[model samples]
Target: MIFVLGMINAFAANPAPPSPVGRTRPPPPPPGLPIDENILTMMLVALLFGIYIIYNFKIKQKTPM
Candidate 1:
């Protein structure tokens, strides 16, 4: 009973913030890197690889694999 009511309230609740003027917000500034999606993906991949390396060395994998 309570679970169903909670679910109904959750679904009925407002999903977005209320704005009187309903003006659309401006787009965010681009990253400092190149303006291409491929370059952005590559940069993110490299960053994740570097982070994984650091995490493995610091936290997990006591011995080098």
Candidate 2:
């Protein structure tokens, strides 16, 4: 399956280095995201509220002909 091929490729891409005492080196820390967490959360909430207001004003149908 595709999952098996992906796993094989992942292992091949980053192989473990040989050690005389059979010990491996620790991995480096991961890179950070583009935006700060607080700003990202605020932007997401604003976007959701804007979408809700737009949907209610422009998309919703009124009752009675």
Candidate 3:
């Protein structure tokens, strides 16, 4: 298409500026809580407890006379 060719020519005419070299960025902030096996175990236990509660409620609802 003419539009596509025109766009390609326009981009080719102007190139992007070169990036700065040897720039040192600041280090990222540390996490609030340390992630270890204890944290992982707690999360897994909470998820299983929530699933157990929901399953029991559904079973109770389906047991009508």
Q: For model 3, what is the alpha-carbon lDDT of residue 44?
A: 94
Query: Is 1 or 3 the stronger prediction by lDDT?
Result: 1
RMSD of each: 8.7, 7.9, 8.6
lDDT of 3 by residue, 1-65 (tens): 99999999998896775565765875568887766849888999999999999999998886658
Candidate 1 lDDT by residue in tens digits, 1-65: 99999999999998896565866885569888866749878999999999999988888657667
Q: By summed lDDT, which 10 consecutive residues of candidate 3 come out lowest?
A: 18-27
What TM-score would candidate 2 get against the native? 0.34
- TM per candidate comes to 0.34, 0.34, 0.38
TM-score for candidate 1, please give it: 0.34
TM-score of 3: 0.38
**Could you tell me which residue pairs clash in candidate 2?**
none
Measured by lDDT, the strongest candidate is 1
Q: After superposition, which runs of candidate 1 have C-alpha atoms over 4 Å from their true positions?
A: 1-37, 60-65
Candidate 2 residues 14-57, lDDT tens each?
66776658557666788787557599789999999999999998
lDDT of each: 0.84, 0.82, 0.84
